[model samples]
Target: MGASKIGSYPCEEIVVDIVVQKSEKIFGELDVPPSKLYTQFATALALLAEGKSTLKQPLRTKDTLAILRAVENMGATVKRTQEQLSIWGVGRSLRPTGNVIDVKNSATGIAMMTAIAALSPRVSVITGDAQLRARPMPHLLKVLNNMGLKAYSTKPDDSPPLVVLGGDVRGGRISVRGMNPSLIPALLIPCPYAKKKVEFLSCGDSLQLNLALDVMKAANVKVSVGKKLSIPNQPYRPFNLRVPSDLSAAAPFVVAAVLTDSKLKLNGTDLASDRGAVLLNILKKIDVKVEVSNKFVLVRGPQQPRGTKLDLSLTPELLPIVAVLAAMAKGRTTISGASEARTMKSDRISAIAHGLRKMGVKISERKDGLIVEGQAKIKGGEVDGCNDHAVVAALVTAGLFADDKTIVRNRAEALQTSYSRFISAFQELGAHVGYAE
Candidate 1:
């Protein structure tokens, strides 16, 4: 598939190729972002609390920073240092800045911030960059309207530039049957501020659902998540938390170690509660050696990875790199249940498939997933990043295992949207990575 204009976005002019060379050995310890969702949720809750909240070790990527800017725009006092953030929240009395909140490239930022904006009894507009505006918005307008907030999309496709005339909401019953589970926090975060108790008539299961419940727990909000769930009308309490490292951000490095037959360590993550537990199990299933400690995970790559089936219905963000791992494995690998990939900033399934197929891997793209025939080694070639961070990182990782130099062009800027230090980290691990001259 040829890269289209929409695939380039604002990143088209940036035009830098991430150069990677086949590595005989790749090893290092890198600090991954504590969960991006955790950071954004914590910030949103902090904005709703009465007292000051202290968050340690939060991920400071472009996306998370956009959320922080939105929090500040919504009348919260934010103090920052090198390692920690202190936010003095406005409680239920949120003040609007009388300006548009532009979340740039963060889909997560816009969703959480829109809910926060709706808590104020005034008009608020939320917008984003082109790529972010192209991503799908959750079907929450009807639910928000039912709760006394008027929310609508300016675009027919329900893309961003969302307008909300919001205020103190009258909470009512909602159903999560058709809603995207990753966006559940947008609904849950604002429930405590509603005039009445918010009740969820039905709840679907997902890792994000569990993470939302976890975030609610830490913020001292009362939530019960069974077949049906409810959040009582109360105040979100200010919290002190050390955010857990992001497993999705760590995935590329893990796969790099696996593909290179090297040992690597990832710091500041707790597998017992992290969303990466499923990825870890998948790694073991594919015959990778993994050791878990309280604070770090140690991974040893196999000489030849054994291919297996994967279901990424709940964790679509991991699909791109996992697909790369599958391409380098010893046999056929099938990935299913990731229809959500189509709704992201890019159609990640198509993007990754096109990139890998260009590198001489046999891949068939599916509506929701992929079927990849593993090769001992694939040919090095050029691939477009398609203005997606995960796809860029995945292509770079695939480059490490290719037969010669690989060049990933377009949207290298997308890396800053999530993992800001991807190139430096790869270089530190002794992998050959550089900008194309």
Candidate 2:
């Protein structure tokens, strides 16, 4: 895929120049977009199904477009309308184009596409842009090889430009015990197409892991879960469903509202699923006032916001912004079980710590997470986005609460990977945010 193709989406550019200033008052109301995770997972499952699948209100960002193209290259036919996108699946009859599939900066996209490609009895090469190429896929590739694909990384460290010769799943039993939760979906999604019944050992559970199972169940794929997880060889039936609002995308705005003591209402976000549940649980620990209706989430700043401990093992992506929220709280906040974040687009743990320290925050970076002594006020300074979208968003939220101006540097790329309208959304709320190249 070419840069021109990736940049063709209507969303904001991947690289953005962003600046934020402390705001005394800001207010807004907007709907959070669909979940990128759900969009990607459902798209992959649809590709494996036997008939047409309808995905309503699926997100159409540059990152997600990569997944769409990758699936098209793997024998799925897609038709887009104003209201929904229709996909005619290949019915477990995997076809590989053999052309190198480009996933751009989407980690989940590349992981799911690689697994889907392995079902085809042909050669497939998976690669991504510079930022994504730096992240390794050794665990995924190694597990795929064991499941009958000749998977390996082009580089020694097991980074992208991954090459796999698949369609030989000699499936009887395999163990994905202690594997990274993010990569487990890569194994489970393709197991049903194996030559024999597939049984797994040590397939741990997480929000994402359960979410994958949810998507599978929706597609009419049966996987018996017990002391051991097992999937009989079968084909996926087509599914139709609307993707839920993305809680990850709504996090920045939620944090901004909390830090600025402003009222914010987010429509279309559910408080019961995915990262939404995680965010809701985290908010209860703090002193914020949140009202949840059937259709929207309303948040108000607390008179005396305080910090508490958090375990981000299942929701590591929340660590960055949560760290910022911790800084603004009234007590010590300990965040643990997010060591996997070190291998993301950037070392988020290090990036957030360094950026907060620049803003005069009392914080300590630990191997697995961070320990922060919350302060009532902090001086604003320049912080680096480290080319990660979540880090950029987190720093921007931090800037909104800082005592003065905050400039987020190295936000030159990957800002739109998840939340393309982050800056625009804040601006609509009357926040003092702008572009500063």
RMSD per model, one decimal = 5.5, 4.6
TM-scores for every candidate against the unseen true structure: 0.94, 0.94
Measured with C-alpha atoms, the lDDT of residue 427 in candidate 2 is 74
What range of 10 consecutive residues in model 1 has the weakest lDDT sum? 2-11
Model 2, TM vs. native:
0.94
Model 1 gets an lDDT of 0.80
Indicate the residue-level lDDT of 65 in model 1: 87
Model 2: per-residue Cα lDDT over 198-223, one tens digit each: 88888877777777788888888878
Identify the runs in model 2 with alpha carbons over 4 angstroms from their true place.
1-10
Once fitted onto the true fold, the runs of candidate 1 whose alpha carbons sit more than 4 angstroms away are: 1-15
